[model samples]
Target chain A: MRFTRYLAFLNKPYLLLLGYIFLSVVLMNFSDTASLQGVRWALLQVLNVVDSFKTEFTYRKNLEAENERLKKENFYLHITNQRMREMVLENARLRELLNLKTEHSYDFIAARVIAESSEKGINSRVLNVGEQGGVRENMAVVNAEGLVGKIIGVSAHQSIVQVLTDLNCRVGARLEKSREKGIVGWGGDPWLDLEYIPKNIRVEPGELVITSGLSEIYPEGLKIGVVTDFSETDYDMFMSVRVKPAVNFNALEEVFVIKTEIPENIARE
Target chain B: MNKSHLRYLLVFLAALLVQSTIVKYMEIVHWRPDLLLIILVMYAVQYGRKLGSTAGFLVGVSSDLISGGLLGLGALSKTITGFIAGGVSRLFQERSQFIFTLFLGGLIHDLIYFYINTLGKEVAWRVIWFVHIIPNLFYTAIVGMVIYYFAGRWLKADD
Candidate 1:
């Protein structure tokens, strides 16, 4: 009677709950069973629809993270690519300079343009190599293109170069075709003025001008420029010649300093 | 089954669907309220301990199976939570203050679930409490109050 009363109070549903819990415990122990796994797999397939929807909503945050990562990667790649291109161009320029040195039998010291004067009227540059690297006053600096400048001042590890465009610069130049010689100097303009050529000399446009080797500063046959314009005044005994320099001074980066010891015969001549 | 039993089943299914689909958007600081836990708490509080424990076991089993979590883990934790909530029901009248019961029940459920989940893991107690358990408790309580208010009305109307 007591058991029946207790059953009635607990209810039929509660009794079934006890039975279900027992079965669930048994199923839990056999969770790795094929049948249970199959059931779990079936339920998972149904639940995956809801999971996919959740993933779709949450994908924006993930995509943003991935975008930031890619942007950083692209920035690094851009810097590296720029550096690689610069290195390739430098390699080619250095190779050309090496060939020029070998062909001319030049005793040369390579130097990089470290700093340039900011003054507008001044055409001067600072090289990384100085007196410590065998650079001296008035040493000729040239590149594969042509004559650049001369070293005017030297420190232990740095030197100052006065470029050909400077008003103070004067080089002994000779016309390639006629062998006519003149003094090349800047006349407050972009072109160099080749002065002291006799009026009778036949100087023409596009004629090659080179170092005459008479000044003891630059070697013979080193290019100065090509004669661009020439005119003779009736009152003057010399022709006025304008020459465009072979080297682009504005874009100068690397250069070679000639360290040849002058021969007694050539120096005396 | 009976009308009440059918009602509970429908509510459970609806809660599960919302938890899976929409509740993620309600997260604050990467924490979301447990809608299914709220529903389970409400059912356990309305009915007796035996019925409450039974509902918890079934729901926990279903959750584990669907989520591919460890077998019997959720069932064991939820069952204990249901039993505790059922025992605590006697201290307060079920109709006058059912929301309190729901909050307490949800808290207990979360505490038990977190404890079981963190076992054997190297997670600190403070991290588990602050990062996971505390935020979830408050969120579940607030959301559960709203659900209970509407569900209570529906239950009364059905009666």
Candidate 2:
């Protein structure tokens, strides 16, 4: 009966505060004990719920960040798709160039058009191949379409070609149908002039022009251009012939450098 | 728990979040107003010493765990602050008089906290009071006045 009265008396406010004080001091001294650590772990689990609440509350913010990431990814994929399309087109074009080499027995060196030197010499272009790679002066440069130019300058690793469209450049060309030979030259005009073809030579419209191979620079039987129009005049001794070049000079990327023969090492390159 | 008790618990959680996230931005030099202490003082003034100390113990333990501080230090200080604040609730004045109790309780709380935290070091009392305790108490009391202006009716409705 006395112990029950004592327990009832300990339930008072001041006595309860003392009990709490004692508990706090004990907790401070034994904070690192395993039992307290277990309690702390339970409290940490409560905090994890708080962390989950924070995450849900910030959902809109995370969505905005995710939106930014997707935008960057979309742009990167767009650029990659465009590059892949270009690669597909290049693959088909390279396959056509490979067929042109197999069709002809002439040993050829494939060179890429590095730059168009239109500022220095009109229609002059630089090639990635050079003299060290067996690109010598006066070697003919062709493509799958037709003849492009001839090598005029060469260094250890690069060569420059004076394309046929230059004002000073002239090619010995022949009409495949009429067997009429003339000097093909550009006079700052879009169409090439096939000079020295007489009025009675009977050169018709849409005639194919091929290199005569009369010069040491150009090889025989290489396509030069097609005759688009022909006009006869009384004062001129030869008829005026306008020939459109078979190769589109504006879209040139790859070409073949060839002569009578090429070295086996440069052919591998 | 009753509705009022649940409401106070939610308010305490909100204060805890704001204290951790936003209070650092409001810090001046090195001293800051303790929001948890202000809530404890206000709650103690309305309630009695018994409920005041209980709320104080819970808030202190939560703060210690969240801040990774030494355990039980905050509980010891806050328990005494709540008890003293509750004792002064019988003063003959309006509810705004609790600001004085807030200042007193704040000073006492800091004394207990710094004393125990520093292992009863009397050498740092001057620096502790002038630099930390005084400024923090002044700011806490001022903020408590503003909070009472807004939420004092909830406490007064019971009386």
Candidate 3:
């Protein structure tokens, strides 16, 4: 009798849920300048704080090890740093010699990946840096490991890094070894598929892929991933190469958003 | 608000924090169980549909905002899930195993989300439904058992 009595109110849950849904939808769509909008913005800031806390929280554990490595590897670090500087100068000289008009240059803002989406299809994750950190939309994200993604959406104190693994993400990448080029798209799996790689081109597995910087989104020379698998058929015009991303999306706790220091006017070409 | 109501709010808030933070470790191949859904279902069943539905909506909205998802999608889905799970609880007696109630409900909840959000025909339905959803169902069911027992006791819900 009690169970049936409750069944009589079964629809009550539905009604209640519907009401809440309606209310949330209404509140979310409420126009700007409303006090509730301010509350919503404040709540978003709370999420950002939580994100930064997650970044610093995880980095704390490895602080000692990182320090130790930095101390001991000073010679190696110095050499690598010198090599990087030389490469930058060489790249600038090459760009100048080619008489190619440089456009859309970016200054990278080093950031930490504070949080990531547990689920895929959701292309958004919170980063520790925001406008205060000099991050902006369309800025590329990478780590020492490789290309992460780009900043699709931003909050004042927090920004969203759309991981390259997201279904909606696409990047212009080229095979470093072969110079084979294609648009890399997330294939709804952990692996990324390099689309439009001509079948005739020889792309062997283990070839490194890097951002072409053909588009304004990412800077040149940033690592993307390594070729893991390639499917080629005589009948197909394109070879589909599966790439294993360098950045471990699963364990990523820190990242750097490649921010171009170039002024907006100079960037737009 | 009554003392008990405030207590429930605290518990719900704590649950949200854990769901957002540490429980992220439970992810398997991008298939993660919705902890908020489980809590909402349990609340809806025990507290009755009205409160359950309201809680569900709140959970959905909060999750969307915190997670930076398509703003209203999670909220809408959770509200419906809360109502359905709560209404379904009337089919069982109070003494049912925690696993039976929570695991089954949670499994169904995830499947619904997978289908609604990603399993459409426009994209590759093969991966979404067959590869992802089926595995996720089993995984969430296992997680649901643990969540059910502990959460049931924590919430002190009779049904």
Candidate 4:
């Protein structure tokens, strides 16, 4: 009987695989109610350990390269330091102009890009930040280059960011030089489209675009993208404009979730 | 039964971890292979439609939660994929490699989704049909082959 049973088991190898997949789907998907904070913290700690090791390894490798380069060209080091000082001063002055004192409030929680959307319908990416990291929904996410997106969903150690180029994303943006207001939306293509700008709003091909901050999703004055081209129709109420997004959706490594001061007057109830 | 079930649970957790963390970063022209889609096709080929549909629903929900899309969308898509894969499974000889079936299954699954997404009110038919569907089909089909080979090895020993 034991030999007969063993033979039966060998005959149906796929049944075991099916059972494995079935059980996995249930375990990973449905369990939402528990705090699971301890598990998340543990996982994050492990990830942090791994990430730190990776960073340290990279840093050491770079330092060795820098040492070799510095030995070869000792004279250029002085010029590089001076250049770095000047850039730092310029960045400080810009931050002052942006009113960094009172407006910039949220203590940013740095996150890592862990996952991205593999499906056609969903145009979202996952980050390592979540409720444990003080990430709240609608938090504006930005990289050093420019605006990235906002936090739409949160898990224990992960959150999903809908990038600016997604079809569902519609940003309230204004021309930096012209101050002409228009709504920027993605057309499922790489370029973003600016809609509802009157035919004669004085927009040009080279004008810069910035978030108007009307949507309350992103902070005002963040660089969104550059206007690449425009087209006008005689019967249309608004001109169709193409924009090149500032943030490359394909190559984003790290982004900052700006904690903008939501005005008390128009705050969501 | 209990020990084997525990092993199954571990595999699912491992799949979710990879699906959410690693697979998201893999892109070729904004096209990522639905790893869960590959998993579902594998199961559908192994199990009959009834069990396959149930597995599909579960995997879909997990995908939705992790992908952060509409909740039921994964469930709906996976269920459909499961049914189709199950039907297709009948066409092949029982001894055939699971990878062949998975390769065909993934191609059809992605095509169905691409058409469904592009046919809706949200997208221009030309844009969806040409830009989205055509590229994704080719990309996913190529990925499917890789996944099929590894899957056969992974599930064969584990099973």
Model 2 chain A, poorest ten-residue lDDT window?
A: A114-123
True contacts kept of each: 0.13, 0.20, 0.34, 0.22
Docking quality (DockQ) for each candidate = 0.06, 0.08, 0.38, 0.23
**Top candidate, metric TM-score:** 3
Cα lDDT tens digits, model 3, B1-159, are 555456567766766666656666777766666566666666776666577667777777677665655555666666666666666777777767334556555555555555555543345667666666667656666666666666556665323
Worst 10 residues of 1 chain B by lDDT: B116-125
Indicate the worst ten consecutive residues by lDDT in candidate 4 chain A.
A32-41
How would you encode candidate 2's per-residue C-alpha lDDT over A105-161 as one tens digit per residue?
A: 577999876544311113466666777788887788999889898876565666667
Each model's total of backbone clashes: 0, 0, 10, 0
TM-scores of all models? 0.45, 0.47, 0.79, 0.70
The TM-score of predicted model 2 comes to 0.47
Tell me the deviation in Å of residue B110 in model 1.
Answer: 2.8
Q: Give the DockQ-based CAPRI class for model 1.
A: incorrect
* Distance from true location, Cα of A95 in model 4, Å: 14
Better of 1 and 3 by DockQ: 3
Off by over 4 Å in 3: A1-41, A48-63, A83-106, A118-120, A232-239, A261-269, B1-5, B26-31, B92-104, B115-122, B157-159
Candidate 2 residue runs with Cα over 4 Å from true position: A1-7, A45-269, B120-123, B155-159
Model 1 Cα lDDT, one tens digit per residue, A179-228: 99998987433578888999888888999999998877798898988899
TM-score of chain B of 1: 0.89
lDDT of each: 0.70, 0.71, 0.69, 0.68
